[model samples]
Target: MNRTLYSGLWWLALPAVLGRLWWRGRKEPGYREHWGERLALGGPAEGQATIVLHAVSVGETRAAEPVVDALLKAYPDCRILLTHMTPTGRATGRQLFAHHGERVVQAYLPYDTGSMTRRFLRRHRPRAVILMETEVWPNLLHACARMDVPVVLANARLSERSLRRGQKAGAVMQEAARAFTLVAAQTELDAARIRSLGASNVEVTGSVKFDVTPPASALEKGDWLRSHIRAGGPERPVFLCASTREGEEVLILDAWQRLADKPAGSLLLLVPRHPQRFDEVADLVTARGMRLARRSQLDLDHAIDGADVLLGDSMGEMFAYYAACDCAYIGGSLLPLGGQNLIEACALGKPVLVGEHTFNFLDATIEAVGDGAALRVKDADALANEAARLLRDHAARMEMGARALAFARRHRGATLRTVELLQRVIR
Candidate 1:
């Protein structure tokens, strides 16, 4: 369907959207509090030219960090209007940009109906609208075009799978693609895909996520966490499953269990992608007869006492987990959920392992494996074997970690390149 039909359907689906929000709000109360903002009914921040940047959820919000910083530095006189679809993303935006004071204004991006889109644009009067990867809304793009608002797709990527899905929509996606004033893609493959989808102005800008340097404080905290987890004295290998999805946790646990003769005090850090699933994952670990420690329970003495597993249940602490671990199994790939960012682990100089499905970060994963920075296993059992072997062989693990750091360092200019593109948009 085209933009007209899509907009009509979106309008008709508002009630369903609200119902879904109500359902999600039962587990996460923050969703219940932001109804007005989702409808463009919130109060606006007066003064300063606004540039609206949309990051859909937690991952996108995190990836936007460097871009946000660059934007803040480049346009000190302007206010950054950050918009998000999920409560987690909103919370992250606030946490990340709180230091900037009123310079950063955050709210929900209205649903892609003409009325809501028009109302939001009218309210913000933004100089330009920048959308994080893969957030192509036909009505929103159409509305931006009509209002003469320049729209940019930053750190954009379109996998073969996503391209095929877009092909199903045909003209709707093509029209939406045309609305991008600039498409700063993560790779040349992404640039080609976006061009195939009818994006005219596209550039290969790598991934802005690569530009995010883990602060010294986070690294120090990670060192402390490592010591805290191994408080009983024997230094054990720490394995991290970062940003895991639903089915992957069970597979990960099974893999961890299958490892023969794991070192005494070997610790597995399991981090779920969603906050609501923290308790669920912790219970899963307990059900498997493993002692679980939650990161949220600040009492490290009590939390880690005789624990085999540490549940990374806190928000915005992914870097600490990456830093603390000796080797990491980047999650979401095992079950075809299109993988989380493996770059964070690599940046911290950790040996990385991933499952077969990493199409979400296909280029990065392929490059990492090719560079000997990571190992990709076929299934859960292979993952267990690889992790076990790497843990046992310190020299091999350190070699891989060195490669991982080199791989990360080589791809570090995307944020600056994207900011250059944004400068042209504002100009």
Candidate 2:
């Protein structure tokens, strides 16, 4: 489709988009609270030399953290304008960079319609635009090009399925890809795939997630929580099913029940990917006859003492969860939902397990397995079995954890490399 058609279609979908925000706000009020920014109706930063960075949601936003800090240090005079589509992402941005005050600006990126995007660009007058990962939009790119705003797709990756979709779109995707000033890819394979999709200046800058360091405060908090739980009785292993989606929870619960050999007083940390599903997941946990303790309701003292499962229902605590767990099963892979990031777990020196489907993080998963930092299981049952076995074999788990830490440390220069690339455009 051409620009006009694409913009028209986006305009047509505005109601559906707003309706989605309203529906999602039933569970997360922040979705409904940011209507003006979502419509590009919010006033701009009101000055020149602003840099705009777009990260779609929590994962991308987290990955963009190091880069945001780097940009702030590299260009002190320029304000960093961070935009995100989800409430969680916005909240995360606020927590990570709010210390900078007005030097860092946070807002919802307007919907990818022609007029809205154009207005956003004209109003903000950004020196450069950087998009985290493979979030490409025809109208946004076209408007950026028309406004002479250099666009960079940083930490870019293109899955096989995504490449196929781009191929299907033919000219539209090709033209959109061409509009980018640079595509700083995570891997050579990602660079090749994006190049095949018509991105001209593609470079393998590696994955910035490797550069993320778990906060010392989170580590201390997790250690305290773990010690308190152990103080209640003998030590019990904590197995985290991190970032699980809707369909996969049932499978996990089934596996949890089938694992009759699980140690007494062991805790299962079930953290759903979406906030909206917390209540639904809690209900599912109770329906399965398992006692649930929500993190939101729990204090550091005795809250998790006798709970069969701990629902990580709070936000901005993923690293804490990773540090608290003995073993973790990366979620979103149990079904065909690709996979969530295992980098945090690895960085925390936690042994990791994954299910069969991991197309979203294919290269990273395979590399971790090759590095002996992670293992791939066939299904939910295998995931449960492996987690239990790892918990039992303390020596083996320690070895794997050591390898995980080593693997993470070896890939720590991506953020620096990505900043070097962005400097060219920012200059």
Candidate 3:
């Protein structure tokens, strides 16, 4: 199908889309709060000079940080009209850019109906549109093109599976692909895949995630968390399982129980990717007879020395979690979900473990594994074994952590390169 049919379909699905949003809001109230913005009905008054940056959800929003900083610095006079699809992404944007004040305005990107997108464009009057990662909407791109707004895809990546899906989407996807003024991809493979979909101005610009520096506040919080975890006891090795998806938690929890030689007083820091699943994961820990303490409930006065697991139920503390852990297992990999980012763990000089499936970050994973910065386990069982081995052996853990930090340092210029590319389009 072409752009017209795609827009028509989006329009037809409006009711069901609203229904789904309402259903999702039962768990995450942020989804329920932005109904007008979703339809391009209400937002800031039009004609503000702004740069539109679309980051779909949490990961994209986080990945967009370095670029956002660069953009703000490069264009001090212009305001950033940040747009997101999810409430978490919106919240994240708010937290990350709150200090910027009126310079960074945010709103929910409307559904990809031509009329709605057109309205959104008119309301924002963005000088250019920069879509983070792989958000290629036909109606939105078409609207941008008609309105003469240059669009760039920054920190772009397209896995083979995603490429196959795009190819299957036929002309509509190709049309959207061709609409991009530029694509700054994470790797050469990503550039090639994006090119195959008709994006002509593709460039290999590495991942912006590598350029993200751990905030000092986050690191300090991590030290405080680590101190609390070891309060009145010997130092405990903290193993962080971060950004875990739904089905993978059961496998991980089961694997945790099966570890033959888990270090004494070892702490498992379990952080689920979605906030709605925090209570569900907490229940999983309690049902399994593990002593649990939530991050939300912990304080300087509260001691969690006896707890087997620390549930990271709070948002925007991932950097602190990375800094607090001795070793980190990047989640979403254990069950064939394209694995979560291991870059943050590596940046923190923590030994990293990932399950076999990391196709989402394939090139970086391969390079990190080859450099001795990261290790890939075949399944949940192997993940537990390797993590146990690392925690038990201090020398091996330190060596791997050193390698991880070195690898992270070697990839620190993506944000600069990405900004240079964006300068060509962002008027």
Candidate 4:
């Protein structure tokens, strides 16, 4: 009743709705980039898929890429439908799977209302639906169950905060989750939470993000990085500020503040998670009384001497940057937003440093730190100290890095497990 009333009011507020979407499109550069696909509806149709996959944003989408590729190889006739709630996810999907996108259609997901959900269900008519991460839209799930579409939650993770909130929305969340045939969660903790949300068929399948076949562009990234700043050589170590978020900026700047007193020729690459914040972060960096240079404009052939910091003002190149560095400071944890996938840095054999608040990646971080694969800094000073120590001591860095790489390789095969689970539903 409430949903119907809200949706009815939503239609009445169409003008405001359209205006908001318009402003949103303008604000997000990625939305502009993907306007062609959205306008063209360039992906596969509803009947074209035996399975449908919806990922909310870039991280979730990236995690699903391996599963999609595996499914494509296994089931030649089944088309893949990829949907995203965020423009960045759409843009990243378009770029990552450009040639195959004609088969793997991309679009903004329909709003999660009964009518819209039903329209989407009927239109796609997929054999199974995979909702990556923990995106659970109540109306959509209800529609899926009504249509008898076998739904699965792949790489599912439910945060403590979300679980507490779901406790309040307990009835609704549980009802929605019960509609799903199974949920392949990332960890035992995740599976426990999903079961609490009323998914009886829940299973822990590990995280598919860990199992991605490294992109062919990996070597090119290393080459590009080597050309710019020589590492494992006579050059001063290059420290990458990988994926720092808003609140972490001051902490990062403080880290840089200490580094400023060092002799010339060291570098800090500040890669903010969102591309929209590049200019904002860059402005902040400039205000700190340090020289800033954009990564795109760099003469990589020359050495980076006297360059204070490099604002990694681009997207889809995180893995490349990770491969081409001495070590990195993973972001989000520094602020309070749990943290992002440090496994990317680990895969590149880069020792990682994080702030104290890491409940988001609790399992992975703990395992890695326990295995000496990463360093956890309690505060800003520790972050700076660890980074400096890692940079200066080649043997110590490599040992930690080697442990990190081994940890990454050890955790491989989540994609296989996820694919195996999907086969049951698709068949």
Candidate 5:
């Protein structure tokens, strides 16, 4: 519960952690060695203050992009280092911020061993470390605390599952959180969770994800997708199953077929969760005897009369895809993975129907439901009927879409408030 205990565990766990990292380095491509890390922290390159932001994966990395961009602009003399836990997130970060990367580098978070954490801290010598979301590694936090590097946790959300796990490891995790000089939580519940974890200087700062200024290209792409799929006819209902995990594709496909009799030209757009599974998903679609067309191959501005299902295989285009659909089923929630962000779809003005197992985005889901921006379904059958009815009534769909957009707009400034408090942690 104190610094001594926290650092002691980190010391005892160092050997096992380093051994695992060294062993796994042989199997993982992005896990290769980084000598530059030593240089990165030894001191600032020239006249820049060092700042490190650690985000576990793609979603968190994306959530921090605006903040990252804003920070780089605001602190012209500061060097920003972004660390990601997953290869996918690293790749996305590299692509998204290629220009800033020279000064703003991206790297894997060093394994949570005292030595590795010490070495990482010594190398990057981050003047400040801002941890994104909920990664509370003991050794690293202790190392930062020892070195007096201010650590701030920002845009944090605590779901029931994560909170329970944190409580089970309450002693260490609480100390780890306490090492931080500041904590910016996404909601009131999150602020309480952090405080209960022994995190002081905690502030409720909404969700930065709501502050995303989606690029201009999303509208262009959305319009193209809409006209192409509808074939220049009346506005059609497209039941988009977004970020679907493995095996959920079949249930979604089945649901689409179940609604076949309800409409004349309704369509389904299926987007699997990962880019690596694009080919696999395409194979599954054809194997299931469903006709399909790829988004890249079709001219979205025109019309495509041949496709029954449009596969959204492109990466970084979810905004456009969400915008193109009339009604959507946010995946992960339905097939039991606890769900993806329906708030994003709603932010783009699409009425979303989610499955009952949405533990991750419970608050956002509840708020959307209360606002009439989203609908909840138990399984494939209910999802099908809900889609059919919404699709049949254009006016109703439009109204729901308006409500969805309005809800998104209402939750806008969490990121700014989060950053304002976070600045205190650094100084």
Candidate 6:
């Protein structure tokens, strides 16, 4: 498909897209709150936007933190215009950049129609557009090209599956790929795959996630939370299963229940990836006859007693969860969904466990496992067994945790390289 056809299709699907947003809003009200911004109808008043960065969802929003901080520091006079596709991404951006005040403005990225994108670009009048990760919209790229606005794909990655899908998209995806002024890829493999789709000026700048430092406030919160988890009883090992997707929770819960050799009095911390599913996950835990306590309802000062499972129902506290746990199992990899980021857990010096289907983070997972920072299990049963073994062997856990921290520290400096690449296009 060509650009005109792409734009026409988007216009035709506009109503359905809006309807889907409304449907999703029944569970997550944030979707209903930002209706106008998605259409380029209303948002922050016109200002000199130095850069417009699009981070699609929570993971991308969090990954963009280091790069955002670097950009702000490198260009003191610059004001950033952050954009997102999901309400959670918008909320995460708001929480992460609340300290910047007016320096960082945010909005929902307008629909990828030629007119809407053009309106968005004209309204912001940013020096350049920087799309985080794998966001390459055909109409958006065409609009940027027509307007002579340079676009950069920062901290980019493309897995083999995604590359195959993009190739199937054919002309539209190729044209979009070619329109990028530069691409700061997370790995050489990513750079090569992006180049295969016709992107030029691709540079391997690594992942900006390595540059993100856990906030002191979050660490302190973790310590306090750990204390509470251990309060009123003997010290218990906490196993965190974070960023779990739809089907993974059931498997993880079943595996936990079937574990015959698990350490005594160990607590399971289950955090679903989507907020709308928190209650659903809680129900899953209760259905299994396990006691569940929600993080939202718990008092910070009180001890969490007799709860076999703690449901992490809060948002923007992933780092705190990482810091509080003895071992972490990064979710979304058990059945075929591309895995979630395990780097946060590693950066906190926690031993990590991941499933075999981590194609999305294949490079990072392989390197972490090779460096002894992470262990990859083939199935949920193995994940449970290995986590149990780690909990029982304190020395093995400590040794692995040390390697995890070292692996994290060795992979820094992506933010600086990405900022330097942005500098080239901003001028």
RMSD of each: 1.3, 1.3, 1.1, 3.0, 3.8, 1.1
Greater-lDDT candidate between 4 and 6: 6
Candidate 2 residues lying further than 4 Å off, grouped into runs, are: none
TM-score of every model? 0.97, 0.97, 0.98, 0.91, 0.88, 0.98
The true-versus-predicted C-alpha distance at residue 7 of model 3, in Å, is 1.5
lDDT of 1 by residue, 1-427 (tens): 7777877788889899899999999999988986888887885664579999999998899899999889989998788899999989989888888988888888888888878888888877789999999999887888889989999999998899999999998788999999889999999999999999999999999999888888787888898888787676777689888999999999989888978877667889999989999989999999999988888874535548488899999888889899888899999999878887899889989999999899999999999999999999999889878888888889999999999999999999999999998899884
* Residue-level error in angstroms, candidate 1, position 252: 1.3
List of clashing residue pairs for candidate 5: 41-123, 41-124, 41-125, 42-123, 224-300, 332-339, 333-339
Residues 113-220 of candidate 4 have per-residue lDDT tens digits of 467677767777888888998788777788888888888988889888878877776566767878888889989998898788788998888888778756878659
Pairs of residues at least 3 apart in sequence or in different chains that clash in candidate 3: none
Q: Candidate 2 residues 20-116, lDDT tens each?
A: 8999898899998879988899855567589999998999999998999899899989998999999999999888887899888889999888788
RMSD of 2: 1.3
- How many backbone clashes can be found in candidate 3? 0
Q: Each model's number of backbone clashes?
A: 0, 0, 0, 2, 7, 0
TM-score of model 6 relative to the true fold?
Answer: 0.98
Candidate 6 wrongly placed segments (more than 4 Å): 300-303
Q: Regarding TM-score, does 2 or 3 come out ahead?
A: 3
Q: Model-by-model lDDT, in order?
A: 0.89, 0.89, 0.92, 0.78, 0.79, 0.92
Q: State the lDDT at 185 in candidate 4.
A: 90
Give per-residue lDDT, candidate 2, residue 401.
98
